[model samples]
Target: MSKIVKKTKHKKKGIKIFSSALVVLDSKSLVFFDHKTFFELKFPKNTVNDLEIVGLENLNEALHKFIKENKITSNNIIMVLNSNLFFEKILKDSGDIYKEISNFIELTPFEEVCSRTIQLDGETRILSTNKKLVTTIKDILEKEGLDIQLVIPYLALDKHSLNTENILEVNGKKDLDQLLKQLLPYNLLTENTVLNGKPAEKPKKEPKRQLFLQERENNPKSKRPLVLLSIFIALIFVLIGLVLFMNRKPPEEFTAPEIHQSMPLIAPIGSDQQEQTSGKTVENTTIKVVYDNNLDSAVLLTKGLSSLGFNSVILEKAGSESNTSKTYIDFSTNYPQSLRDKLIGETNKIFVDTVVQDSEVSDYDVVITL
Candidate 1:
């Protein structure tokens, strides 16, 4: 368990930095430390629903007013869902995050390469070690009605006492048990531990119970065989891929017995009467023209946004959160879901419920409805 969460040791100087729950309302303050510092922020004075937060509204009013009053430099935040939110298959054909495991979970311009791809607040067990802390933070957030900007793990530390370089491996109950005893306060293991559904917990640690990593490893063995693990993982990938592949309107198709009926057979044909594939995609040089209703100057600024990579663009109408951010830009052709983030970033506008269905552009992508 420690091995999984341990910091990747480096030869460079190690910095002992203090951490705190950070909330960023404005961008200017923490622009320099985006990666190093965990952050949850919003533009000040932006109304989210019926509430408004002053970008300068000190969450820790007076008690620690020095942070803002004196312009101090400190805060540790970590509230990134992309870090550990869903099952992911590091794509072999594409590295773009907009290409994810599901159509249900929308992708955004922001992507973080933290410990896990996602960590659902509840009912998530794959990364069981972080569950308790995750749930604890989730409760606090919901109860306080305070949308968190970040929540660094309380057990997280780079101290030499817990040698980050050590390696421990075990398959049997005895070996696994010994391994659990080593990780002290950080270890979330139960004293009445269970292996193969039987009880086994050593009486130690302040808390009587903790999440035994070895026990979690055992849970899989009881449910299914090891050979099926590969098949299960593969099945999950296909399931997600199928969802993303839906609603994609390629130019042509044909029946092939060898091709699985479950998979859509779209043979992409360009304007040159050439057949291409998902593998041979290259960056486009064509201009995109957007006409969003949200912004007054959307048409004038549309050309610039297109140059940034939108194949063809036009606007539709916008929607709401939990609802969909919409944008229907009539291009000369079709497009894909991949356009969501680029469109959002380029125009500084969001499409909660949008789609681009253009017939004029012959070699465009797909008609996105995301």
Candidate 2:
């Protein structure tokens, strides 16, 4: 028995060195990411309702097809499942959490359930989900020689504190937003949630009609002053407009400058010298500067870049700690190398030896991190 156990341990050790993948399972899709690099892989998408036999069949078929096409062979697998399927309950007593979870599962309507328990403070949190789905994933992967290491509900992901770069690889913004809402509720949504990584304007919550009317009624005097001020402002604006119109100069009489083409233009020393002497044309480009709670440094850096003739903006300030304080710069793959070199040379003091990489930033030429 000891010899057999030794052999098993040796086999487990051998599996760790190979490239592993994380399989993220959601209601509508299954995404595969090369775990170490977070490089995403092609995977199948199937809208599933595990409770239904037909849904499960389609999901199984999709998984089978993915395995066959990819020729996946190994036992290193990490699974992140959608939280919507999980059922969480709080138990008052600090009794055996596992036992409580099993009892809750037995009473629940779900025919197939798996449970996980956590003891926090004096209370027990029990989370249960569809066991059939988990089993299906395991069986499918196992058949393809993939071994499951961990299975976690997406909401409980914060407990593990997995790499955030993995989250960045997920394909869709809608899916990313749903994942963020489930995984990290306290963290404010940022531009990173979108595929392009450009800041997306969040829809402003409209004021409740009844509340607005009630507040207006309560402050009737406030409304009159605002109304009068609006009228006064409008009159002032009209007077200013009339005065500007009167001061406006008539179209300047066209007196064309004498043609200077007849004079031979003196050539510069060399083409390169001429190009170097040409005036710099500033672009109307916006650069996104994302920082980790260090808004003062970010603000100062933004000012510095703005002074250097680059259109810069402080894109985001992450409320939480990032994995690294080392800054990063991401720009277009085709960005001019000379400008890039100059940018790094000038900002090297502030950003240090930050590595630059390629990324998609909507309406922005580059993105910076600090």
Candidate 3:
């Protein structure tokens, strides 16, 4: 007997798919809106501790990893900036909106501000943020193959919400409907969203017209002062280079010493002798943690370093003096090309101050100031 043969196709399984990301940025955490489900992630403690400092390098890594592991491949991203993170100012109805915003931002207290403007009905509103934070966010998102569709202030939609008495200003369904309508022209909707029981098509956006919230006016006084300042700096650097070359020291020859039975915990600059100490000495290096007023943090750092197999001491601002003067190696210039790569990689792992000044120390490889 011959049996009829049939082929059956199997569908793919266990793949989580997401079309778009609605990223809500608040002071404490980030909430991602994805297909009727919300995922909230808290910022690590003290990540945004300073108002002026928004260091997101570590957060960027974590976010990118999350997106990759979850198989989220959508390119569209919409950001809702919290009122705490964004600044808003009303621009007066004047001759030039751009010029008014420029003058206003100059007088604002914040440093390195980036701004965007939007005209609603008849009033113009300026949305402002720290330039560094915006740049870092955009760079990270772009690196993850995502493009920012919209960056709107959280409070901007609060006005449209029905419940305005709440301090948090959480919006309702009506506000969301209004926001969706407002962003319709920008084609911010994904393919899965439905309108009238049919899939909504992404609208075609108009061609680019002009740059947004940028200083376009060609004022002679705007950049000439900066140009002159640059020339002055270049001349100063040239003068310093000449002085350093004229006073340069001669190179000294070095010889390797014979191997010893035991290495010293703390050795003199040229001596191989080890000194006896009551406290435990770790390895051949000593790390000093310096702080102005936070001795608690310094102590914590000392304990942390101790756990990491490094001998560390806490330096208080009152009675402690740091000694970093023993090292003779200029990290930037005095290394072979092959060793330079490894040396730079190692140095970057340690956080040093911008202007490093060598202090006096017997057996120290690095000095860190907090």
Name the runs in model 1 displaced over 4 angstroms. 1-285, 288-296, 299-327, 331-341, 344-353, 356-370
For residue 186, what is the lDDT in candidate 3? 25
In model 3, the clashing pairs are: 323-360, 324-359, 324-360, 325-359, 325-360
**lDDT (Cα, tens digit) per residue for candidate 3, span 90-113:** 778675654565566665445455
- CA shift of 147, model 2, Å: 2.7
Worst 10 residues of 2 by lDDT: 1-10
lDDT of each: 0.34, 0.54, 0.49
Ranking by lDDT: 2, 3, 1
Q: Per-residue error at 290 for model 2, in Å?
A: 99
* Model 2 lDDT at residue 40: 27
Candidate 1 per-residue lDDT over residues 1-370, each given as its tens digit: 2122323333434532333222322211211122133322222233121121232224223213323443434322232222233223332224332223222122311121112222223211121223332333334333433343333222222221322222111334454344334322222222232222234334344233232322232343455766688899999999999987995678677776695589788976653333133321224423433332435555545555656655455443335432435554443333333443455445445344455456654444433223
Residue 240 error for model 3, in Å?
16
Candidate with better TM-score, 1 vs 2: 2
Among all windows of 10 consecutive residues in model 3, the one with the lowest summed lDDT is 1-10
Candidate with the greatest TM-score versus the true structure: 3
Q: Quick one: ranking by TM-score, best first?
A: 3, 2, 1
Provide the TM-score for each candidate, comma-separated: 0.16, 0.34, 0.38
lDDT of 3 at 166: 21
Candidate 2 lDDT score at position 272: 42
